[model samples]
Every structure is written in C-alpha cells, then in structure tokens.
Target: MAALAAPTWRMGTTSLFPRLFSSTQQTRFALPFFPGVTLTIPIGIQLGLPSIPSILEGIWEGILKAVPKKKTSHMKKRHRQMAGKALKDVTSLCKCPACGETKRMHHLCPHCVSSEQLLHSLQRRKAHPADIFSLAPTPNSILSASGSSSLLVHSTTESTFPLIQTIPNAHKLGCHHVCTAKGGLGNVAASVGFGGEIKIWNKSQNKNEWALDWEIPPSGDVWAVALSENEEYLACTTSDGRIQVWDLNAKQVIQTYETGARGGGSFAMSVDLSRDGKFTASGHESGAVYVFNNDAGRMVYSLSGLAKPVRAVAFSPGCKRLAAAGNAGIIALYDMQHGEHVGNLTTPNARPAWITSLDWSDTGDYILSGSLDGKVKVWDVTRGACVATHSETEGALWSVRWLPKNERALGPGMGKGEMFCAAGASRSLTFYREATGI
Candidate 1:
C-alpha cells in the first residue's frame, strides 16, 4: 500500500468489483460491446453493468409461480371434555394386583371395558384362567376348578370377592372345562378332566355348594365341553376326534359323532351350544369348525370357511349366526340358517394381531372381539364396520363376552344395555359398558 490503492467496496454478499476484473487493465478489456457501438458512448457503458443474476432471478421466480400451494386441514376440532369423561380411568377397577391399566379408576380402560361388557351378558357369564380348568355359573354363584384337584365356588353377586365353598379331590388330576345351564337357575353343572372323565355336579337345597352328581366312565382325555340351554344334554369332545353326547337325566353317552375328517389335536379349543340347544359347535386346533345338529344327532355342517386353528366360536342369541376366529387374525361371520358366509370383520393394521376371543351382543346388533394384541373391538354387524375400539392391555387377551344389559334396572342414559367381562393371562377381570352420555 505504498501508493494506497483505492479502497474496494463490497455489496451484501458479493463484491462491487469482480475478482477477475479487479485490475483496471483487466476491466478495460473485460467490457463487451454491441455491433457498431462505441465503448465511449453512454449506452455502451450502461450495457456493461452486471445483469446476469437479475435475469436468472426472474426466470427462477416464474418457475416458482407455476407450482401450487398446499391446502390447510378442514377437520373440526374435537371436544376434549366429553371425550375425557367417556373413558373412565380403570387402573384401580379390579381386585387383583396383577391388573395394571385395568385398575385405574374413572378412566375406562379399553381392554377391560370390551372384555367385561361382552362376557357379562352371556347366560352363563363366567371367567377363569387357563390353569383354572373349569367354570360354571349358577344363578347366585360361580364354581371353578382350580389347577389343583379341588373346586372353588364363588358368590356371583356378593359385594366382596368371596369364596363360597370348596370341593377337594374333585378331579383325578385336573378338569379342563365346565358348563352350566343357560340361566344358571338349577344347581346342576358339568366338567371335563384331563383323565377323560366327565363329572356332573348338583347342589342340594340344604348344602352350601355342589357335590358330585355323577362321573361318566373314561372316554379319552376330555378336551372341551358344552351344555344344552336346558341343561338336559351335555356334550364333550375328546382327543380322539369323538364328540360324546350325554343325557343328563339318562346319565349315559346317548350319541357319539365321529368328527375324524377334521385334524385331530389334543386341544379342542372351543365348544358352543345354540341358544335353542338345537345345534352344537366345536372348534379344533386343526383350523376346522364343526356345527352339529343336537336334534338330528349328526354333524350338520363341516364349515370350510376358516383354515387357521379356530380358537373361539359362538352362536348368536337368536341362533341365526355363528362366529369363529383364531390365529388367522380374521373374524368370520356365518349365517346359521343358510349356512352361507355372511361377512368378515377385519382388524385394523395397527392392532393386526391374532384374535383370541369373540362374542355376540345379546341383541346380536354388535360383535365383540378380543385379540392377542390386547384390544377389544366392537363391530357393528349391521353395517359391517368397526363402531368403536378399546385398547385394553398390551398382553394377550384370552376371553371376551357381552354382558346382559340390565335395561330394566338401568338409570337414565344407560340405554345400550348390560355390560360384559374380559379375562386373560393378566389374572384379573375387567368390566365395560356402552358409553352413556348421562
């Protein structure tokens, strides 16, 4: 800077003088000229000004103008207050310690709500652990066979969860399933054991609990059982693929249907008797569902719709529909009258897991399903759409049933009807009711 060169100027992020033409000698030769234009003229000097960026910017803006803007959401805002109250926190609702979310109070937990509401409506509303083995609902109490060879009776309506009575050595090893009359009016009940022995129990008017009414001779390992609505007929399925029907009064295997075509697995997961006791259905591990006519004493339909091992099967209250679901994660609804596939209820992908339990609402207006993913979904059969879904737990849900809505006793707004009960590996029972604004 001996001579102190003229100070350079700078514009925003660019240089007033380009680096390539920083020297006066370079700038002189860098200027461009139009034909017949003299460099000394004003027009020629003005044209030499930098204008490449301006032209590029104009082209860029024009391209941007051709693109469209995104639209805003038009959905209405939801009211937080009512939605909050409708779901009562059920974290503390159940008596068992293992019951987690089910125990929270006031905020209805989805798993418990769906399970309790549906199962509570069944004629013989009952729940038990897989290890418990047997369940029988009496008018005023429920009898269960514990994993032990003993049986426990619980009062159905007591304020506290009280054990009414116990029977020791009720089973040689352990009973697997049990059945009672539809109404539970009489004290009669039936149970099937691992030893293939079927035992009937009855409570004397004077006795506090049930005593062994009779035990059928060994057939095979008893896997499943069902009782007629009238409690006059008892049906039991064995590992050998034989369905043994017993006359409760005559106390013998009146008829036996050889259901051998279906794959024979040791576990016949489910057995159901139609409301009218006209039909009996058995779901096997081989993914085969069989519906038998109790009146005809023969297999009426060997249903072919489902191929996955059928875990649960139920008949509608009117005996017009039969539903079966299992590991396939599909709920198949069949018309009992026409023996045609009526429709299918699909589970959402978020909860797209195995379906473990299913039951029809008392009116048959809705079908409730419990899945291994711990969700209870209420499906509107009339519309073939899911009406509501409750996330009950993160654990597998073993059972769900619609409760008998006691409409007559319900106060205002409790319109939908009775509640249901759900139970599973969680070792607790959850109750749920249709949302009533009141």
Candidate 2:
C-alpha cells in the first residue's frame, strides 16, 4: 500500500458537525498502486466519523421539542376535579320515596325525623274520666283538675305514678284552675272553681292527706289563679280583669292591680306569679298582658301585640322574660326590665289554633306550649326556634306542665333531663320525656 495525502475541507452550514469540520466542496481520494483502479471518497464523510457527540445532542433536542412539560401540581389537579364533582352533586335534587316530598339527595329527610321523634317517648294514661282542665306539678306529685267536681292527685316520685288521693266534691262546680307552690312538702295549693270561689288547701303533716285549709268568699268570679313559690301569697284573675294578690298566711287581700276598663273591664283569662314572688302577670280576653309590681302595688307594664284573646301568660324561671300566647297562634316574648317586645315565635304555615297553656323549663332555656290543635311545641328561646313538636291527638289540649327536674332520674344525653305532662279533651294525661337516644 502506498501513502495517501490528507486534504483540507470547509464545514457545510447545514451539517450537525459545523464546528468540527467545514466542507463546501467535494474532494476525491486516489490509490497509488493501481493506475486503472483509482478509488475516490468524499471528505465530508471522513470528517463526520469523529463528531458523534454533536449528532447525538441534536437528536435529544428534537425529542424534547416533541414532548410537553407538566405545569400543574398533583394536589392542584385533584382539587379542581373534586370541586367540579361537588358542584354537580349540589345542583342535583331528588324526591323522598317514603313521603313523596322534594329534598336534597344526600341530606336526611327533616320531615321524617321531626314527625317520628317528636313524641317518641310519650306515655298516656287516663287520669280523669272527663276533660282535664289544668295540671300543677309539685316536687313529688301532680295535681290535675277536670270538669268533675273532684281533684285527682298522682304521685310523681314513683315510676308508676299511682293515684295517691282524690279531693271529692272539692268544687261544687268544676274547677277551672289549680296551682301549687315550688316547695314540695308543707306547701299549699289553690284552686279556682266555676262557681266564682277560691279554695286554699294544705297537706296534713302526719297523714299526708290534703284538706281544705280556708276559702275566699266570691267577691268576684275568679277565672284563674297562681301561687308564689313560697306559698306565702296567692294571685287570682277575676272576670272583671282585676288582678288581686292575697296574703295566704294572713288570709286577706294584699293588693289589687286593675286593667283599665276596656269593654267594661276585659275578662281576665289567665294569671301567673313569678317564682321569686317579685312580679305578677295577667292575660286578658282583650289581648292584653299586664305585668304588675308587687312591692309598688301597681301595673308596671301593659304589654301589647296580640290582637286576639290572650289565654296563657308565664314568667320565665329567671323572671327576666315573659311569654304570652293566645288565639293569635303566635307567642310574644317581652323583656321584663324595659317592658319591650323582644321577639315573636311563630310556626311556619301554622293553622289558626288557640294556644291554651305555656310553661318554662327550670333553666329558662326553653318554653313548652299546648295548643287547641292537640300539638305540643318546645320552643328554644335563645335561638328563637321551635326545636320539637308533637301532635298525637286532634282534640284540644287545655293544660301542659313541666315536671320538676329529678337529678336521680337523668339518663345519657339528658343534661338536666326534661319531662312534661299534658292534659286535654283527650280525656287522658299524656307524659312526654326527652328522647335521649336521638
């Protein structure tokens, strides 16, 4: 083999190895020995063999340009998908199969829970053969009044609530109202009869029997009556709308607060004395509610709002608020200090029904109301909402009372547990307890 001569070449601008070698013209290589068989090869091919790194880099750049970079984080991508799914779920609506009512698909049926659990723990018993007019609960007993002349007493301390006694012929005409003081033993009870008379009764210390202690002759027709917590005083509403407070210990009239003569003295329908014995409140047939100051012996505030007859008036346990209800089908709450109407509690789409009775819980956190539609409602005062409702009978309910809180009888979820008794035209006493299981 003969030696071959090297040739210089310029790199072409379009070649991948433009810096490694330059080539613009083609060159030919010649073999020395064979004169007739001289071989020729291009200079660019010879120089390109040593430029493998630049060719590889150009291929990698081409691949990267064809692919895309990830711009979104994994968590951001997942959150966007979830938000879209939730929006779809919220807009979707469905009908409840059981009641054929429209409701949210993923939420519980409110109507079903309210109707089924309202009276879930109720028990009924025939306390009076006739319609029960009033109920008064002591620390250990419940006194009920009916159209019958006798007053029935039931022991509440026992689980069975046995019939303890009956005051036969206590009221020649049926008793319309009955009330007891807060103290259990040695406390007195007062009753107003249809015959326009008031009777005071005391329990026997030795025999534990109730007997007539005294009577207040009928100066006027007494329609309703209430006793102080200490049993030291009694307040009664007369047909002439006169609120008269009597000293039980002295057995004489102490003060008379009169509702001004509207329509010849609006008939006083209901009266209640504060447990603290500081105030007296009366509801009249002319839709008037008057709160009187006992110390000053005068009407302090004449509350207005209900345009229909006022049937029930009660002061809260704290004596800071008063609730009044009647044929208006709504309850008006009043602040005692300023005598201003604070708020009104009304049911949505409620029918026209007379609210006959009202009572406050021991903590004054809730109010219990009985209506002529046979529905009992528990009102949450602070929230201004009706927390529970029960309608077991179509007959009218005349009276409802909250039982004294029994600490020993409390169950789970029964923080200061609650129990109430209701009586009415159903001719049976219905007892309701908090549904702790709920």
Question: Which digits, one per residue and each the tens of the lDDT, describe model 1 over residues 298-374?
Answer: 88887877777887788888899899988888888888887888878885565468887777776788888888877
Top candidate on lDDT is: 2
After superposing candidate 2, which stretches have Cα over 4 Å from the reference? Answer: 1-124, 182-186, 410-416, 435-438
* Reference-based lDDT, residue 163, model 2: 78
* Candidate 2 lDDT by residue in tens digits, 85-169: 6644444356654465665543334454454333332333666778999998987778899998999988766544667899999
Name the candidate that leads on TM-score: 2
Runs in model 1 deviating more than 4 A are: 1-136, 158-161, 184-186, 261-267, 388-393, 403-416, 434-438
Model 2's alpha-carbon lDDT is 0.79
TM-score of 1: 0.63
TM-score of 2: 0.69
The CA root-mean-square deviation of candidate 2, after full C-alpha superposition on the true structure, stands at: 20.2
lDDT of each: 0.65, 0.79
